[model samples]
Target: MACVGESNGLTFWVAEQKDYEDVMSISVNIYGGNDYLPHRYSDWMTEPDRVVILGRKDSKLVALESGFVVDEGRTLLVEGLRVCASERGRGVAGEIQRFADQYMQQLYPTLRTKRQTMSDYHSSESTKSLAKFTELGRRAILSFTGDGKSFNGFISHLKNKLNSTTGLDKAVSVQQMVPLEDAHHLKNILLDPELPKRVQLPGGVIIQDWQPFQPIKGNLEILARRNLTWLVNKLEKPNFLSFYTPPYPIAFDGGSLRFNIDMFGTDLDSAKRAFVSHFEKVMEKGLLTGKIMIHVFLDQSLWKEMKEFCAGETGLKLWREYWEQVIMERDVRGGAEGKRESNM
Candidate 1:
């Protein structure tokens, strides 16, 4: 085993294939028992231009952090940051973060920034920590709960509401989903170089299932690997777009499945149609069971309307209150630590 760094009784090691069990042991009740680390840990081990650093004390796992090189190697996207429950107050998170930053600097000397998404970002020290970071963009997150049995009801309710809207603007002209594997069409839309600044995207950042990535070729290629279902209202210069990531088992509500649907655009009608189409597609997959936690990330303007529609129509409970997933970045220089170099 290669030890990367050791200091003050804590040792940092590059995560190996055999350390999965030990990592799982330290992660308890993370993300309210729906932690994504457990499901994606193995995949992170094999992903290119990524590194998972394990922090240990006396040869025992105490923390885990991962950095994915994105934005064409100029930025390091931090994810799966966790500290052992027993070691929380000992500055474990800060240490692991510093370790990952230094290691990445050494590995990728051209690195200019360290980026992170703020969801679990809200800790007791959220306000103070946030003050040091620059906000890139954020999307409103609304979480709902239902299952395969209630999926059809949810769609029906959405359609019924769409049908009865007296306000002509409530009418959704398009409810049909694009072909799942329309390779040529998807490439055409995504190939647009200006996807970053498009008004459809929040703050010009394309966030897939809580992971914020710049809409560039390298990042787009990274998103392509995930078995995501891409849907848009049109094939050319589309006004509506959404991404549906496959459901995976969670440790909440008797092993419920969690599905993430990221909708981009402010049109209420198109957003409503997106739910119908995405839900139907998920139904066809037949992967859902018992309780399904659906987290919808969309424009803030559509949050209240969509929430009211879903709650009043389908009667699904909220997995959590309304939250915003903001992407924050801090500038990095040669051999930087977790310290704030400058507010970017």
Candidate 2:
């Protein structure tokens, strides 16, 4: 009983158990261009009671969406929704969403169901998605990553930086309520004496550390070290590190580093000042190098604070305009800087 939909030359159909493996393979082939999805699903499907939706055609599968029931059996946990590149933008995703909503309602009438998606931690998407996902259940989690040259290498570099600065040997630890993947890699990094002290949340929820270098003089040294470590670690762990290409394929042109700060950590004004100060230092020294540009990524809360900060302080306002101009010009260049922030 496969439900089907068609557009243009392609068709979409509800996949059967026989179509699962092939559909998975197709999905892996397309989405596997980045490690995030594969890594997430690899961890997720290990659990019992997980349901995955697959799209297929003539016994060949093409796309998948997966989720599980969460909240002591009162809610559905939709990890993500993904479509095959070839089958995308043709209403296949809408069909999948419709099917999923109806299917879950029928299967668990008493349970509230919800879908989740990852968004840039510093962007409006992150905050909005968090709200939407929460409305669907008790607590939906949002995840973020440190700016890195590559994923695996970034973890390693972060580990090294933390080890040197904080004397923290645990490379990976997160506070509870943070929905983060890569806990295994974080734990592994922490186990190494050479890695930074990784802190874990009480219940094994979220994991992270502040920028590793401390004391003003050590800033460049720390940045250089972290970048070098990223390169070295990539060569060492080819499989884990190979998945990401330099976001920019060309040589040092200019780049942006964006990160989200935990607003709950401290006074908003103080945090904004500290971040701006650090960014200025990094820029003045050409640490990013090659006519580098910096763009601060922020959520609505932080964005509002930043806008206020820029308006109130003359120097900060100048810097803000400077970077904004650079970003606009680069947008005209069609360079990597022009690309939208990665969704994960």
Candidate 3:
């Protein structure tokens, strides 16, 4: 492991297999113990394309950071970074950020962007604000708008919608995304062996099996590359949906699955059908029955119908909210600034 200098007598170095335990052991103190690491943590830990670094004060590991090369070497994504409670005020994070800058400089000389996302904030509390602050000079893409309903009487209320067709003539294909080895559904979409599952970022950094239903915009790859997409489907027209379960199960109760939907036209009916179908499948698999949610911006044309359908539909609820706004910032090619120390 390469040593990345020191701050306040704390030494940071590139993480190796032996450092895994030390890194995993470092969690926010607010919780006493880390609940669970995100799925990406496991993926990056094992993936050859990613890098994991750790900081130590003598024999005790105190800070950690994981990043991956994207778009070839033009961008370095600091996927996960954390400093233990004891080292928070010591500038250990700052030292590692500087080291990352130097480390990438030698190998990826043309590195243009170093990006991260709010989605990576698994155990931290300042996730929302951290994301909002990171948009300063970087391009932000509207990820999703989320809405959810309680499972108090979901099963009973879902019968009518399941039996009656809205004459909408819409069909949606949903599959639960699971690890390749643990996957059981024969109808899995990611199982297709022939298609190009991974997308190549700008710098020739290829994201293994990082396939999306369609090519994501260049700037949006930061969000796409980190999370694995399992179930994906095209809506009736001008709409899309993709379901992602981070590398690990998260949240309380059995954890929740996250899905993103793009509603660009008047296909709210189809969207609803697709959502219910997906929800039913998730329930059938017993993936989650607690509270499921989605992110979407309703089109004005379908607002009335959606409002009525949601009000009348017993199983589903519509929440008018934007998960996040994608704000585009000027590309800062010169080593971007380090993310401020946040509890997120």
Candidate 4:
């Protein structure tokens, strides 16, 4: 409701519900009303924890940015940003960003990490502007389809990429799954008695006595009372699988899930074995109706181990082209940390 500044008589103001129509119009002009910009401004502005801002001149909306704080208020993820075509290069985007930065400082002084993501098809100008605010953290390449494929197909695709002597050397292998059920498949896998309840290492080292985690019910009751906020909370902590001595997690975005494994102790090989075992156990469950997209984080260190494990005639052999999306990320935090190379 407060005016942040002006650009050539264009007044940038903190957005209110009245600006929703203008917001949707700008989004349609920019993203063609595609799934990319699917939500209306009210969808964000009405959220209790979100920050929405708009820039306008003479009652005409010029630019917009929407974001939310996550990671216990340490990180702010900018979800969407748009500028009217007529206002391009007029410094409207920069002005709005400055306003956002000030707002964040005032609201959450402890905020440290500011992150954002851009899809492969984003305009070059959009990409450049995003890079200006936050450094590239990680790139995720993903594939989506309705065709049903076994979970093993996901592993096989990565194996093929690894086997490629010339390509996919820098990608971190992972999968994003959208199950037909409520993704209870993961919860079932964890509780299945037939599966090994331990991290079985390469040398038979076992981290045993697995137990299913039930998130603390402190906020569950409150969250249940507030549905939308609860969903947002759940999406924010997608990787929260279970509470263990050493916590490992999975990210659930609506119907989809993202799994990532990283070794902490010096026993890297043992960690890798345990991780692979878990991967196989989940994949063994298989999918019922929908397709799961596989994503690679181009710089994951585990690719070497995976390649080594899947070598030779006894190893799992796979071919490429089963996946559809490839991501490349560059680290601009602390000022460009070398260049990122990818075969995506």
Candidate 5:
């Protein structure tokens, strides 16, 4: 006999291990892709988690919800929720969320005191879904990035503005060039105790700098794990840093830093708008610093798309033009000379 319950316009059942293959099929179908199943299954098996399947007696599967324990503490992360294609608009996904929350509260009463973290909501692709999920009382934490070009323009403008006031032209310079793909190498170096002395900044503060200058080449999984450790340790606050590769690769050195956007799915306008909005928010928060390197990964397609998007849209074009003017003006106003002197 199938155990049944009704909460959000759907029937729920406790999915068993025997149901794994079937539920996995439903997930792949709901997502319209099979690539994520192995990872999904791995999470299910290893993580203290729950999988609630939604369906009608006549249907195989209408929706699926999964949550995992995280932080080795009280928080439970909603790993993923997907409604079958044919059943999407029926509010099945929302119901699944409600049930998941209630079920967790009942099962782990301690979780009520600890915050719930929805992992994987930072990407632009995941933005809409994440927003919807957050409406159910989840907090959304966004991650932002600026490719090399955007970073360079922003830094140039900032440097000019600072120099105009302080009369100090050069604030910082790159000490070593590291390939973006070699972020792992940087991670290893940072972890090592015997590396050369860390770079000293203008205020007598010493910090290590990792400049990712090229596209990463190895397995993304390994890279993500390495980068996550670096991010948690290095990025203690929101600050701009260069890491080559536009639409930062999904994997960081730490497992995958899950975000909501499908980087490949975004159109040029959307991409530009997303980046600009994130940048403005970051700037408004006053986190800009000249020491930050904006890493940009410019693959052929992304570059072409960005170029076309900039050319076609007046707002984007203006934004680009304004930044360019800022850079040029800054360069004219002692930036170039400062660089020359630094070379000496």
Candidate 6:
């Protein structure tokens, strides 16, 4: 492992596989067990584009952060940031982030932007009033909890409702967007000429499974690694689209799967149909089992309508009310004057 630098009495090291256990140990209770580090740390270590940074306070592991180069190395995504519980209230979080920004600049001189995403709760508490960051946009997250059996039952009910829909609704087309198969198609749709006027995307970025990706060939290569389900309304004139990031187990209730359905369009009817279609795709693969936490992310305008439809029309109760994920970015190519401490 390579040592990066020291700051504010904290020493930095390029985290390796050996540091996995310690990272998990310190982050056990983080996010109330919904932490993604434990699940992605192993892969992060092996990914050529990712660098996990460990911060030590007086020789003890006290914090961890990762910077992954994406958007063709023009953007460095800051993720898996967590400071050990014992180190809370101190400036360790900010210091480590500041140090990280500097270190990443040295490692990747081509990086022009630094980006991070946070829960609405955290974003509200952050000092965004400063000129260091730009608020890209936010997606509303509707949550629900159920076991595999319950989810199966819900899907079955949804099929019946869908079957009863009019012929016009049945004609609604949904297609899967794969990397090699649909790379150009995906790029054109995401970076379409009409997107700016429609403003379908927030800041022209695709935040999938909590990772904000730009619509570029390099970014598509990064995304192609995941087992994602992409559904669009049409190949010619697409308006609504959705992608379901396959479920991964979270440390909630012994262990439960976290499934995310990201809907990009504001069409209430299409969003609802795509929601069921994506769930059906998962069910077809027999991936649902045990306890599962479902999170539906969509445009803020469609949150209330989608929530009502899921509960009243689909019979799924809301696990929690109204959570939003805030996506933010800052120019690092000489625009940011000083240190940028991400509160994500």
Report lDDT per candidate.
0.79, 0.35, 0.44, 0.41, 0.36, 0.78
Question: Per-residue CA lDDT of candidate 5, range 130-234, in tens?
Answer: 432222211111222333234445534533433444455466421121222355555553333322122111111111111111122222333353332121112
- Order the candidates by lDDT, highest first — what do you get? 1, 6, 3, 4, 5, 2
Best by TM-score: 1
Segments of candidate 1 deviating more than 4 angstroms: 120-124, 166-174, 177-180, 313-315, 334-344
**Model 5 vs. true fold: TM:** 0.38
Worst 10 residues of 4 by lDDT: 204-213
lDDT of 1 by residue, 1-344 (tens): 87989867899999988999999899878887778887888899999999999999998899999999998999998988888898887878877887788889999988998888877337335666566578877788889887678777767776667767734344554347564367667776776765544536765677888787767676767888988898877666777778899998877776888888998888777788788778777887786657888899998899999888787645478778778788888887743443334333
- Summarize candidate 6's per-residue lDDT along 1-344 as a digit string, tens digits: 66779988999999999988889888887765677777887889899788888999887999998999998878999999889989987878888888888888998999989999888777655664234688898889888877787776786565555555533354444332322237667667666767533437777778888899876667767777876777776766567777888889899778988888887878776777788787777888888888888889888999997776666443466787898888889887654355233324
* lDDT tens per residue, model 4, 1-344: 57766655667676788776677677644422122333335556666557887777788887888756544555554556778877777777767765675576577776665555444455365655554443332322222221234445544644454435335443644332222123344334333332231321211111111101112222223222222100000222222121111111112223333232322122224323333344454455542234222222222334455445444443233322222111222222222322221111
Number of backbone collisions per candidate, in order?
A: 0, 15, 15, 6, 35, 0
Better of 1 and 4 by lDDT: 1
Candidate number that wins on lDDT, 3 or 5: 3
Query: Could you list the CA RMSD of all candidates, in the order they appear?
Result: 3.2, 17.1, 9.1, 13.6, 19.2, 3.7
Q: Which of the numbered candidates is closest to the native, going by highest lDDT?
A: 1
What TM-score, to 2 decimals, does candidate 4 have? 0.45
Which scores better on lDDT, 3 or 6?
Answer: 6
Task: Look at candidate 1 and tell me the lDDT of residue 61.
Answer: 97
Q: Cα deviation in Å at residue 227, candidate 2?
A: 26
Structural similarity to truth (TM-score) of each candidate:
0.91, 0.37, 0.55, 0.45, 0.38, 0.89
Error of model 2, residue 4, in angstroms: 13
